[model samples]
Target: MINITLPDGSVKQVSKGSNALDLARQISEGLARNVLAAKVNGKVIDATLPLYEDAHLTLLTWNDPEGKSTMWHSSAHLMAEAIELLYPGVKFGIGPDIENGFYYDIDFCDYDISEKDFSKIEKKILELAKEKQTYQRKEVSKADALDYFSKKGDEYKLELIQDLEDGQITFYKSGQFTDLCRGPHIPNTGFIKAVKLTKVAGAYWRGDENRKQLTRIYGITFPKKKELTAYLEMLEEAKKRDHRVLGKELGLFTFSQKVGLGLPLWLPRGAVLREQLEQYLKRVQKEAGYEPVITPHIGNVNLYKTSGHYQKYGEESFKPIKTPVEGEEFFLKPMNCPHHCEIFNSSPHSYKELPIRYAEFGTVYRYEQSGELHGLTRVRGFTQDDAHIFCTPDQIKSEFNGVIDIVQQIFTAFNFNDVIIQISLRDPQHPEKYIGSDENWEKAENAIKEVAEERGLNAIVEYGEAAFYGPKMDFMVRDAIGRKWQLGTIQVDYNLPERFDLTYIGADNEKHRPVMIHRAPFGSMERFVAVLIEHCGGNFPLWLSPDQAIILPISEKYQNYAEKVLLLLKKHEIRTVIDDRSEKTGRKIRDAELKKIPYMLIVGEKEEASGSVSVRKHGEGDLGTFSIEDFAQKINSEVNKLINY
Candidate 1:
């Protein structure tokens, strides 16, 4: 018998060669039925894979993210099988599960496919799923893999196999379709009760722009049909809340092809909104003992070379600008940390002045692919709410905990109550991907882990998700509609300080390198505003609203009253606007609602005579009447309540 440790810390002695499904059966039949996969010693694998020795096992159901990933991976195979059956001689490149769904790239020979064919493909997938075909996994030699695909005349599979080693190659076969995969798949196709092919687009093979463009089909699946129905409803709601659509409707931001792709033009209202966010963060940083700094838009290429960023990300940066002098070149700044490091080195520091924190709202540029750019979320030019802290190694945890406090306050103020904290560490198998010594990496990684433990954060550790320089504490916040967005990040870096040759006079009268902490509560102004737009559906908090209230005159007769009311609100420092258009009162109210303004102050003869206004709240109409002074006090009270943090 071998000992299997369950997640609840229960040890069960079972027969050797028993798998996770068997263990689940021992626990409860219902659990076994729900089990889609299992995590063995931190690696997700098939529930049917037999265990040869003692192992730690965690049964994964639909509730677990890995279980969902396994189901989606299996559904991809099912999708490929369905498409292959429907359209013969179609060669596939790759299909993998993404955050929301799965997509497959296919080189369809002599056949044109589009979104119109999605229904038929989905129908075929469902039909094949009902067959309950078990997914069979087999290890194949590299030569055998190449020969099989060669016989099938698929160059994409051959190219993929050339990079893979002999013993590491594996193929998963379900129904009449088989493909190369390193898989942790579901038990059977029956787990996919519902399937939806969302989109079809052109994708270059292996993301190489110079290569052949193949048809890529995107899809999603669920175990139950009702769940799919609910997902579709949520998708419809998402469309309505999409920032690109609402940004234009609310006059927040825009883009133009003449200027450039992936660059946003912030309008007047949008600038005010962004400025408010910046001011709020500035106040918070001031209270936390942080000093502001500024950096240029361009930096000498050697600056990045010294910081190791150019070595890692040179290809993604915009082309360097060459001066009249042959060797002198400057590149658009890809990161702000390198410049900040130089600033720290410019002045000598002593141990008494350790823990220096520098903050900047620095704008940086990157050359993102045209196809990948999406409104404000993925932009070429964006500003980061970046800050760097230089402290002794012993103070790492306290500084990290302090940053976490600030992050929590920001999230609380924004109503992002549900957040997923991720502790990202380096991948042990690929040490070459990171800089710095093992000792430094260990110290940095341990600091974050200890901080998470001390803070009692229910965080998940994700291997290989760390930045190239160090480990990261990432915040994945769920929006009001349940969509997850990575909003904040804090990284511990010992590498950049070493590369920059930064040091401080220690208490022992010796020079020592100071550890660097890189943090951004709002990852980028563009992306944060995009997420905020979608999260609140453009109805910003009273404190952050571009125009907190708009005075709408009921008719031409109340135009004087509207201006007087606006002036009074302005005196109170409330962001207010006047709507003196000749349009009807109802039309003005409707337009104001569309803009998502927080409050509508309706002024008429009665309100003018009484020196008051009829107020209506967005999404909750009829807030009753209030005197002008009383309304100003009310708005200030609400803003104070939100900005108290």
Candidate 2:
């Protein structure tokens, strides 16, 4: 018998060779029925995978993210089966479960596929799903695997098999279709009761521009019909909130082919909106004792080499610029920390000034492929609200908690209440892949976990998600439409200080390395704005709105009053605009509503004489007439409530 430990610290003695599914059956029949996968000793694997020794086991149900992933991943295989039944002689490429669902690339030699075929394809998938075929996993020798695909005329699988070692190759068979995979799939096709094929697009076989283009089919599946119905509704809502559509409609930001594919040109309105977000964070940082700094858009190649970013991310960075001096080169800066580290080195510090926080809205560049660029979110160049905190090892937990407070405040101010926290630690099995001593890595990871628990965060801890340099915490924000986006991140690093040879005087009058904490509450200005635009459906918060209020005249007769109202609002520093054109008041109101202005003020002859304006709120009806001072004060009060942090 072997002792199996569960998540809640309970242990059960079970016979060796008992798989996760058997363990689940021992616990409860319902749990066994719901188990999609299992995590064995921190590795997610098939529920049917047999255990040879004692280890920690966690049964994954549909409620867990990994469970959902396993379901979606299995759904991809089910989808392939359906496609092969409908269209034979189709060569398949890689198909992996994405954040929302899954996509499989196929080389349809003579057959053409598009969105119009989605209905029949989805129908076939559900039809096959009802057959309730179990997904059977079998290990095969590479020579046999190659022979199987060779006879089947699937070069894609043959190519994959050639790269894999002979003894480690495996194949999964579901229904009449078989594919090469190393999987933790759900038990059977019956788990997917409903399906939707969302998109059909063209993709290069291996993401190489020179490779043959293949058709990629995107799809999602659910355990119940009602769940699928709800998901389809969310997709419709997401279409209405897509950032590109909202960006164009709201006149916030734009892209120009002349400017470049992945570079965004911020319009005047978008610039004003960005400035407001920056100023709010600046105020918060100031109150928190952070010193603001500015850095250039490019840095010498050697600078990154010393910081080790060049070694890790040099390929993704833009091509280096050659100078008149021989062998002198500079790169479009791919990170902000390397420069901040230099700033810390510029001045010597004593033990009295142990913790120093440096903040910057630094722009960095990467050469993102054209296929990957999506408006401002995936731009080639963007500015990060980046900062680094240098403190002693003893200050790690307190400083991390302080930064978490700031992150929480930022989320609250932006109305992002649905927040998910992830604590990523170094992989224990592959210690050589990470920098820093084991002691420091353990201390940093434990500090994050303890702080998260103390603050009642209900965080998820994932091993091996850490950067090569350090352990980290990531904040995933769910927008208004229930779509998750990773926006804020904080990493604790012991490597950079050692790499830079950074030191400060300790209380013992000796030199010691200061641990560096990397943080960005907004992640990047461009992507954050993109997420925010979709989060609120283009209706920005009052404080962040470019035009807080617009003054409208009943007719040309009231243009003078409109101008007076605009002037008064401006005197109170309210972002107000005037619709003084020769148009009807109803037309003016309609236009202002489309612009998403928070407050609309109508000024007529009665308002000119009494110095009062008629008020109407966007998405809400009128609020009678108010004196200009009262309206401005009310608006100011609303803005104040959002920025107390």
Candidate 3:
């Protein structure tokens, strides 16, 4: 018998050559039925694979993220099988599982496919899924893999195979269809009860624009029919809350081809929303003993080179600007930390002033591929709510904890209570992917891990997700609609300080390198606003709303009363706008509702005579009537309640 350790610290005595599924069956048949995959010794693999030695095991079900990913990945294979049966000789590029579901890129040569065929394809997928087909994994030599795809006229697979070594290549076959994949698939096809082919789009073969474009069919599958139905409904709701659509409808931001591809132009209303967020963060940082600083949009290329950013990210950065003076070249800043490091270097520091925090709302630019450029989320140019703390090694934990507190405050104020804290560490297998010595990397990673434990934070550790310079802790927030967004990040970096030769005189009267902590509560203003717009569905919190209240006169007769009410509300610092348009009262109210204003104040003959305003809350109409002072107090009170933290 061999000992298998479970996640809860229980040990199971199992016979040699027993698989994870056998262990699950030994525990309970019900658990074995739900088991999709297994994690052995921290590596996810097929549950049916035989275990030769004692190992740590975690039985993964649909509830576990890895289990869901494995299911979806198998579902992608199912999808490809269905498509192949329907359209003979349909060459496939790559099929992989995504965040929500899975997609397969195909070179649908000479075949016309569109959204109209989604139902047909989905029907075929469910038909194959009911067959109880088991996915068979096979290890193939590189030569064998290449010959198989080359004979099938699939250059895409052949090209992918060339990158793999003989022993490292694997292929998964299910339901008369086989493809190259490194997989931990679900046990069988019968596990998928419902299937939905969401959409189809054209994508370049490997994200290279110069490569041939293929049809990318996106899909999602669920174990139960009801879950699929609920997911479809949520998707419909998501379309209505899509930031790009709502951002334009609410007059927040826009883009133009003449201006640029990924650069966003914030309108007046959008600027106000962004400014409110900035001012709030600025106030919070000021209270936390942070000194604000400014940096130019462009910096000398050598600045990034000295900080090791250019060497790591030079290809992704915007092209350097050539100056009339030959060798002097400037590049649009891709990061704020390098410039801040230079600022820190300009001034000498002593141990007495060790923990120096510099904050900036710095705009940076990058060269995002045109195809990958999204409205605000994936943009070429955006501003980061960036700050860097330079402190002694001993103070790393306290300063790190302080930043976490600030991050929590931001999340609380924004109503992002459902947050997942992830501690990202470098991949031990690929140390060459990152800069810095192993010693510095270990110190940085350990500091973050220690801080998380001391703070009692439930953070998941992910390998190979850290920034090139250091390990990081990222906050992934699930929005109101259950979509996850990575909103905040805090990184511990000993590399940059060493690379920049930054030093401070210690209490021992000796020069020592200060550890750097890079943080951004709002990772980027554009992405945050986009997530915020969708999180609240454009109904912003009272404190963050562009216009807290709009005064709508019943007619031109009460326009003066509207102005009076607005003035009174402005006295209490309420953001109020008067809708004196020649439109009807109902029309004005409807327009304001569409704009997602928090409160609508109506001034008519009675309101004017009584020196009061009628209130109607957005999404919850009719709050009766109140005096201007009472109404102002109500708005201010609500705003204070949200921003008190």
Top candidate when judged by lDDT against the true structure: 1
Q: Give the TM-score of each candidate.
A: 0.85, 0.83, 0.84
Candidate 1 residue runs with Cα over 4 Å from true position:
1-67, 130-175, 178-191, 202-214, 308-316, 322-328, 429-439
Query: Candidates sorted by lDDT, descending order?
Result: 1, 3, 2
Candidate 1 residue pairs in backbone clash: none
Please give the RMSD to the true structure for each candidate, in Å. Answer: 4.2, 5.3, 4.4
> How far in Å is the alpha carbon of 338 misplaced in model 3?
3.1
Q: What ranges in model 2 sit over 4 Å off?
A: 1-78, 91-99, 105-112, 126-194, 201-215, 222-230, 322-327
Please identify which of the two predictions, 1 or 2, would achieve the higher TM-score against the true structure: 1
Candidate 2 residue lDDT tens string, 1-645: 988999999998888888899999999998898999999899999998888898998999889999999999999999999999999999999999998899999998999888999999999999999998888999999889999999999998888888898799889999999999999798888889899998989999789969999999999999989998999888788888898998888888898889888989888999999999999999888888899999899899999899888888888778899888696889998889889899999988897897899999999898898879998899998999999999988789999998998999999999999999999998888999998888888888889989999999979999889988899999999998888999999999888898888999998989989999999999999999999999999999999999999999888888877887888889999999998888888999999999899999998888988999999999896989999999999999999997764
Count steric clashes of candidate 1: 0
Sort all candidates by TM-score, best to worst: 1, 3, 2
Q: Report the C-alpha displacement of residue 132, candidate 1, in angstroms.
A: 5.0
lDDT of 1 at 358: 97
**CA lDDT of each prediction against the hidden true structure:** 0.92, 0.91, 0.92
1-645 per-residue lDDT for model 3 (tens digits)? 889999999999999999899999999999999999999999999998889899999999999999999999999999999999999998999999999899999999999999999999999999999998998999999989999999999999999999888899999999799989999899899999999888899999999989999999999999999999999899999999999999999889999999999999999889999999999999999999899999998999899889777888888777799888686889999889888999999989998997999999999999988889988999999999999999987787789889999999999999998999999999989999888778777877887899899888889999999987788999999999999999899998877898889999988999998989999999999999999999999999998888999999989998888888888888898999999899998899899998889999998999999999899999999999999989888888888899975
Number of clashing pairs per prediction, in order: 0, 0, 0
Give model 1's TM-score versus the native structure: 0.85
Residue 545 of candidate 1: its Cα lDDT? Answer: 91
